[model samples]
Target chain A: MSERPPVPVITPGALARRRLHVMFALDCSGSMRGDRIASLNYAMRSALPELLSVAEDNPEVQVMVQVMRFDTVARWHIDEPTPIEEMEWIDLDAGGETAMGSALAQIGEALDSAEAGPRQLPPVIVLASDGYPTDDIDAGLEQFFSSAAATAATRIAIAIGSNTDLDTLERFMNSPEARLKPLRANNAPDLVKSIKWATTAPVKATSSPTNAPDVASQLALNAEQLEAPSSEVVW
Target chain B: MSWRAGGATAIGASHIRNKRPNQDAFYASPTQQSDPRFMICVADGHGSDAYYRSDIGARLAVEAFIEAISWNLDSPEQINSLPQDIVQIWRRLVKQDIGRNPLPPGFERAPGRASDRDIFEPYGSTLVGVAASEQICIVVQIGDGDLLLGYEDGTINRPLAADTGLHGEQTYSLCLDDAPQRVKYKAIKRTETWPDFVLTSTDGVSKAFVDDAAFVDVVRHYRELVRSGEDLQATINALPDWLRQVSDNGSGDDATLCLASRRYKIQDQ
Candidate 1:
């Protein structure tokens, strides 16, 4: 029940969407050369469908994935940010000493450069490591977290073995915000579970509200209650 | 001096799948209202486990807006107190509702809730409100939503400043402390000239777009749509479906759009 006016104007045909970036920093140190790296590769492949499903369910943000590997040095694994569906994964080669700091710096630099606008969701970073860093972690972290994008990112870590340096991981995952300690995985099966969890949770949070003020904290709380993985130390 | 106005609120796609209620609420006075001023409001409740009561909170925010505008509709100088009045009235309404339905025994709060004692957290919401007469137009915003003033010219003006906190990643809310102090207020009273129309929408509508200019251009297109339509009612009727599509593929959050126009004349059927 309103007044008469002019003819209707056609709107643009396509819907515009925001982007949500998810990155993985895998530890390819010498300790992970055998069963550990193999489990990681398998776990990542298994996790993709679940992540893709979650991303597809919420079309609001274009879910993109980036990957990096670290041993004596860190380098790009995926090379460029790719949509979750198109994010192809290859088995990572394990080598040399842990360069956890170098890995953080590499991913950090990428996020800093790809920096999100008001419409974009802050990037989510998942760090998986099996041992202490052989590189300068403090300097690397400083370089990585210098940007606002890195500052606001959701950071998660996977402790791949009994020898994981919790202190270093904790530094990367600044406390209070990174509510969950590094997800502990002492064996290959546990490693797979940790990787699956690390990949999917934050990606899902990027698209869905989950009815919480802080999805990261909620994820941390849930991760804590997960049933313990196998007790056998197979890593 | 008559006005033409309509508004719509649609449940978001994500909310539908999650079984969450539509957290968006709105009010647009009809052209035939007896009140001299045409008032419009769009409110978005912070819906999550923490804001369990936000749907009600959003409803109350709209009611509070109407209540606040009623007092200051004619007096532009008294506009400074509008935000305070809205907060005062909304909290009172929320308290009354709380007394009627107290938090159940052993009812756990959302884990990420800001503070355990901050009972208002369950009803936090952001709102943009406008009360316009032929001569005076008043706009007030408390959080993350769009408020644009369209002119007879092709240009558009955003009454509120840029807010980095859109789509509720973080935002100010009526339920938060010192809310009135955070409110961004603007009043325009020009007998010779006024905005041709005023447009406001929750962030969900904008989230479906690439950027602010694109979203604003869409608002301009809606105005053109109304101008081109055989009747403004047709355009109004089309909003819900359009918003549904935006939410389905864009923000996946509740969407609401409110428009009030003095420039467009509605021919009575």
Candidate 2:
């Protein structure tokens, strides 16, 4: 009997793809009175082009965008829609009390809703705010991050402008690295680009379930590497 | 032909554009249809406002976006690379179509004058759809609405988020003042172990399934609803009366839904 040479085994690379359900839990408190809201509008307008571009390229990936604006309470600007490419922005109005708890609860409910599908690959929640909670924040956050409904989705927070309670925000994300510090938007252009980055950057793979750990290590390593050469993005 | 898991593509729709006499503005397309790959879904123009063209707007938006994705047909790229590229292109195309900003010459326009049957103004409508293959499920949207999924364990889930806490707050709408930059998406990859059902709908239909906690329960309802071997339309029509009940007595906007599942096809051996 002739013995055949050992056949080689090959395994294809596991495709690392994801479904993005971006719930923008924004603070539309009266404090966010004037240009702040306008800046947000400008930011959303500028960012849509980029958002549409990305959705077009990755057909497997869909985007479900819901805007939960909080001021005295939480209000959604749009119902949940995947591939939010056609999303029209509801210009946020700042009025009423900062019922942060209610806002958080609303977001928690949204996160918990039957409409918000359970994410297998973990959905990313971006909570952008500029102030401290005037209500029972811990309870609301507990509800927000509770593993009751979605055990896999990840949460990321962005604190824009000052007056933001970084410590509280840090607690909400459960990770310091996920927190995006405030960037000063001096002009309309600044507002647009900064908002774009905040909304779009997290959609990238760095914070993804499959890439999170690698991303964390790489970021640290990169930080160390950069520190070796006097840390600063001179370019 | 039919690539969705459920064999036939399921759709649930409701219209509430008329509270007045002599308006009579409502429409749906491919009337009674179920083709998975090349399906065209639309919500018509509510012919009463200045943007009386909105029905056309809704129709055009869904058609335009759907056609764009269907025709692009390129290999799916890395998740990181895809969303950005698609967003950029879609933005350009939409603006160009609106005529506020024109693209370089030769890109196709709907054809005929703005007054023609297929041609209309920057009318508006919200759309959410899914074009799925055996290997991929792509969900698309242009407005406010719900999209839910049923998992293997009889759980129901909505990919879209909803509002909560405090009364009288506004739910988001795909209306004129929309914050386009705030637009974003979450692309999730399906694994052999994860769930395999998709439910896409306009905000009206979506709100019906929104508040529940256990996604599995929702899925259970969906599974139970389909046991009769009914067509997609009838099955959707049988949604709980609350789901079909008009929030504003048929004076509200239209509601639409598209449900697709991923399952093995029982072909004749």
| TM-score result, candidate 1 | 0.88
DockQ of all predictions against the true structure, Cα-based: 0.42, 0.02
Q: Compose the digit string of candidate 1's lDDT tens values, residues A115-208.
A: 4666677678889988889999999999888866777777888888788889988887785755778888888788778778777777776666
TM-score of chain B of 2: 0.55
Off by over 4 Å in 1: A1-14, A175-180, A209-213, A227-235, B31-35, B108-117, B164-168, B191-193, B227-230
Q: How much native contact recovery, as a fraction, does model 1 achieve? A: 0.36
lDDT of 1 by residue, B1-269 (tens): 65677888889988888798998899999744323468889999885566778889889999998888877776667888887888889989888888899976644354455553366767878889888775677888887888987777766789778754323265777866767777787778875457767888988888777676677777887666654434566667778887787777678889999987764555663
Off by over 4 Å in 2: A1-18, A114-119, A148-154, A176-190, A206-235, B1-269
lDDT for each candidate structure: 0.77, 0.45
Highest-scoring model, DockQ? 1
Q: What is the C-alpha lDDT profile of model 2 across A1-235, one tens digit per residue?
A: 2131111111122121234666667778876778777777777777767766655443334566777778876677765644576687667778766666666677667666633332222455666676788888988877776643323344445455556777776676564354233433434455555566556554543221111111222222322321122212211
Q: Report the number of backbone clashes for model 1.
A: 8
